[model samples]
Target: MSAHFKINKQASMLMWTLFMLMAPLSVYLMLKNKTTLIEWVLFNVSSSPIMMTIILDPAGTLFSSTVLMISANVLQFSTIYMKDDKFIDRFTVLVLMFVLSMNMLIFFPHLMILLLGWDGLGLVSFILVIYYQNPKSLAAGMITALTNRIGDVMLMLSIAWTLNQGQWNILYMWETSAFTWQSVAILLAALTKSAQMPFSSWLPAAMAAPTPVSALVYSSTLVTAGVFLLIRFYPFLSSTTWFNQTLLLIAVSTTTMAGLSAMTECDMKKIIALSTLSQLGMMMASMGLGMVNLAYFHMVTHALFKALLFICAGTLIHNHMHSQDLRWMGNITTQMPTTTSCFMLANMALCGAPFMSGFYSKDMIVESSVFYSNNLIMLTIILFTVSLTSFYTIRFSLATIWGPSNCSPFIKLQEETSLTTPMLALSLMSVISGSTLIWMMPMNQEPMTMSTTMKIMPMIMVMSGLIAAWYMNTRQIKHVPLLMLTPMMHYASCLMWFLVPLSSQFTMKVPMYISHNYLKSLDQSWLEILGGQGVMSSSFMASNSMMKTFNTKPVNYLMMSSILMLLVLATM
Candidate 1:
């Protein structure tokens, strides 16, 4: 084995060990109803000691454990997925730093301390997103970096705003008149990080990263950081008058947008990336409905299966000679039973199939929506989004796993032991993690009673979605009526409501135009006339005039000197 592989193996094992320890610790903390805050005085300002605070609560510990678990599996998977890369060591280091940043965010409740992790994630994710070292990856990385930097800036602004309260600790924060602005800042930060509408183009773009990195980024780290931050700030944000309603609108729009985008998407990784965006919207919706704990529950459960899904996708892509196009894949079930089985499990969880990890959390969130008392339109959209989730997920599974093979016949598909190890480990979690967390976490303390129709509404939507997906697959796009499915509509859906252009080109267009005008009016015109060229030309003209005067007569030179001296004396 190569030294890089050895290092990755060791790191994976270390992460697994930490995960094992933290899992039990979180359970113990939750069962005992305990929260331990470890504080060290970093410094004092105006007699207000700024302490480095690490809170070991059920939420923080459990989140940290999940991060460690996913990071460990991802690192192990990378050993196979990235085995041939020359800079595996650097990749390993970046992965470790990403995990460290997430853990830092989880444990630190203080806004000031949390910025360390927040900024670290943005910087590290930019590097990772551009890991492939290509023009497309570079463009993707730029979008990812710039979008995330908006969140980082918002977070920093929130921290600065909170400074007026004499404390940066979220635990100590209470609602005040000035807190509405702080809440807006925090919400914007979360929205950007979570890839909510108007800020969501970056998540799909970030698929330019390696598959292992995508698994980590989409599942547990960079993308989810926004949801996690909001979970921490729920207490303060829930009190804000406009927060929940505005979030609900954005969440609904985002979920619908992602679903439409995923349904039309052909690239396997981008489809999965859109699904992550969809789930993030649901998490935000849960928060909007005042179900913070359930939102966290969904986040945790989503992480388990999402990581599994990406790992399996990576295996498929690797075995297919790095082809991520879904239409080119099919009928690999017989060739790779273990991988297909694991992939189906993750898919089932994603679709909220019966008793799966996603079911426990997603079902509850859907059921809880009945109690939200939001407008009929928003509620209907939420349910529609749920069905859309199943629709696209089933569509992806059908295209990649059961659809006709469109690629060369010679492509051999097999699961390597190195790849299978992490898949199996995460597959087990995908199967049982939801139940395990439900028992351990205090997400729901009482049973929910609802009408029979209300209880089965989500499953009905799931089945309808499944049927719709099957129908859509069976019918060719050309066969569909132009009125129902126009090329423009198709293009719009595939491009995510034209957000791809809006985010990249449109975002830059205004600024570029302003800069262009500035260049014309200032740099090229006014500045040329009034700055360097103007100064040089004016000086030349004055020198020529002086030479002419001097050459004409020494008396002219005396007049010029007397005029200059008189001006100096006037100023004095």
Candidate 2:
């Protein structure tokens, strides 16, 4: 290799090494003395001359640690999953970029710096999602990029609006403006970034990427960035009643819709994608209802289980030459026993089986939703959504693991290696992390206190879902036509698609028209809108008319020329 090539290679290696090291170091630091480690990390984080400060509160520490652990595991898993890929250097670079940005996102004090990290993450995710460069993957990447950009614009606007309203200082701004229009703007940004209803179409499409990219970006990092943003700014949102209510409605709608959609999806990746959307919705709902701690708690737990689930899925798909359709996959439990077991554990967590990490976090969210909203309607919606979550998670498991053998003819089960280690670790974490909530989190709160009604409802929902999933998977119950059985849900998905136009209608005129004609347009017209016609049309017309008038005023021009000559002669 040339000298320049050598230098580039070394730089890439350094970046990869740094990222791999950060995870273990972070865990060690936390374990040594969590308080001191948090204080030190916060000090470093706050040293940046930003408008906000990084405070090492219990919730922040927990979230930060969870992100660190999952990012590390995903990076490790990627090493094995991407081993045979051609663009290994580029892949590693994006992985490092993702890790760096996520670290900054968690520790940054100011909203601006946080946004910088946020947008960086989105860029890296878009690149990873398009790593294959196939037409379909490229399209998926572009959609994800554009949708995330829309969310970013909303965030930027919120920041600008906040500054415009004289909320320059972070603490003061949040204290004074938590419940204002600014809060609504911020909430909208979060909703979009988290892929809540109407903004959720991009997520399912993103499954075109490699399984590791899906595991890392969609499962753990990028998808949850919005939820983390909301948690980071919880103090600001605490006072906004209307914003809170709106968030609550969005969350319920998203969770319910995602759960129903997951039931319809046969692709393993799409099932996981919808699961992520639903899980994120649950987090948002908790935050909307003023359960910041619980929201953060759920985020941590979800990250662990979801990452594990995705990694296992990646293992299966990779071993089988990227066959991701669950219907084509069946009864690999005998061949890939280790992988199957890990997946089952993660699935149990995902379904929120009792005593798993997912159960605690999910129960916390449901309990908090009931306590904070105190609306039986909201509670019922959330409960039903949880049941659907269980059903789909079970559906995913049965479709992939319990059906007749469809393992690829050419592929064989290989012994587990370093690549599979991360999956195994994550699966164990999913099973055990629930204990963290019981042991660490404050359970004295109303939701955690668990009244008789609260305890009974969650159990009933869980049992009902488990039974329902069992019946469906056993083929004892025929699959219902979504439109016939759940007309409202069918319409809700349609409504989500319909709202795209309605929202576009209110936001901008030309872009809406172009988006409506997106794929059909011979050439994109939105670019023309940005090329200055909207701003220059009237001015250009007026100038042309003025030129016409001037041409008609030839006598006036001659008089002016005569005056100029007279003045020149006088000066001479």
Candidate 3:
């Protein structure tokens, strides 16, 4: 290992430590300077305002701080988790690039400069997801990349729309009609980046990446990019009815599907990944409901616990001989109490347990919807989604942590303090970040004070999920309860309501089929025959026939003799 290679524990830890310490300076600068633009003067001429730009805005700073904060911890965690792998240096470089790209995307509020980060995340993610040499990893990388490219296309269209606005800077054009289609374009683009609705399956499949990548990217940085973008562009969105309605529809649908799917899922990482999907949907809906502060609040708190959950799951899988099946994991608390406690705490935070990080954000999101929205359907879905969120989270925690000891006595799991240290750091944050953030936030003028009935609704919903999961799982002996195994519902949940097929079998396949057959019928066949090969072959055949005629010297001689005879007769 090189001194700086991630395989070297001290070197990797040292790097992440320095990076983590530096992240807060950005938050400080944003707070102190308030709205400021840093630009490259060389790139701008007096005639045109077009130039490279970086923004120091509150939203951009919040996003930058959250990404680096979570990533710094993940990077440290990776040093220990990936220590056995020889390519840790290469992997570390990829991870560093991933985090750096996120910071750029957040810093440059201008669409032109921001696309650098947008495109960077997509490109590097393809490389990182396919890091393991296997077909599954390759397929996962393709789905992740191609889905993101759709957003990239939407962004290009957005850039073109911004041309109508006379500048590349999105911040400058707010409160104008120029924001019309540009906002819609940004909304759709953000949808793809966040894996909303039709694109939702990619997030779970992305678990094929190394657990550390999942912890850093899917949970905190990459998937959150879209929500972060929406949070930035939210001011312009309030007047757009269709945009708000569309976002609300997609967010709630994703939330319901993800929560139910997590309940049915057996793979630990997939379960956690699905929970992330559910949380992201909530964040999206929060933005739709005109509570961008609450959305940003949930996003930061979700980052802490979500990373903690994934890392703890990764530890269990690492010890269980890389088996991620919940069937193989049982009574983890009995053997690895430290990891178990961290996992439990993280799970509680995810469930928005009382006074925890998620409680401040998640609870408020549902409750505030009362004052923000009048639509009954939207309100019902949000509350129901919260209940489902609790159900799956509790189910997952119970199954793996205290269900039953399904493993053999022969395998002894190693206890590494380094791995747990990162989990502990995040666990502590999961307990404290929300309390600090709500106070630190530039909040709405006042809390949407609801009746005691409305206020306790979220807690009641949480309790229902807890009781329901306990009653159902307690009765199961060797097999899962048949109620949970309902054929149609289970099928939908497990396969993500046929979204994977819709994306792969149809969305992915139709274009691939057209391209493949087009290559066979056109580019590789008749087009080649007509364009390159056809022209060459036809020229050669015609030239060969002419050459054969020219090679017959008698034909040339006869023509010369006839001319000679005509000239002789004329002379006579």
Best by lDDT: 1
Candidate 2 per-residue C-alpha lDDT over 3-31 given as tens digits, one digit per residue, 9 for 90 to 100: 33343345435544554655454445445
Q: What overall lDDT goes with each candidate model?
A: 0.89, 0.72, 0.82
lDDT of 3 by residue, 1-572 (tens): 44544244544464456556555764565446466788774354345567778777666666666666677677777766787788887887888888889988888878887899999999998898898879999998888888999999999988887775557776666545656777778988999999999889789888889989999998888999999888777766666768877888899899988888888899989998899999999999887777788898899899988989988998988888878898887887778988888898898888889999999999888888876646898898788888888788777877788788787777787668768788888889899989987766667547466788888998988889888888877774556644355687678778888898888767767787889999899899899888979999997897578657776677776875687689889999
lDDT by residue (1-572, candidate 1, tens digit) is: 58988998998999999998998898899888799999998999996778899999988888888889999999999998898898998999999999999999999988889999999999999999999999999999999999888888888888777777788899889876668878989999999989999998999999999999999988988888999999988887887788888998999899999988888888999999999999999999988888899999999989989999999999999988899999889888788899989999999999999889999999888888875466889889888988888888888888877878788998878788878988998888888988888887865556777789989999999999889888877797765622238788888888889998988898799999999999899899998998889989997899798787566687877887899799889999
TM-score (all chains, Cα) for each model: 0.90, 0.78, 0.88
Ranking of all predicted structures according to lDDT, beginning with the best and ending with the worst: 1, 3, 2
lDDT, candidate 1, equals: 0.89
lDDT of 2 at 451: 74
Output candidate 1 Cα RMSD: 4.2
Clashing pairs in 1: none
Q: Could you tell me the lDDT of residue 68 within candidate 2? A: 56
Q: Rank the candidates by TM-score, best first.
A: 1, 3, 2
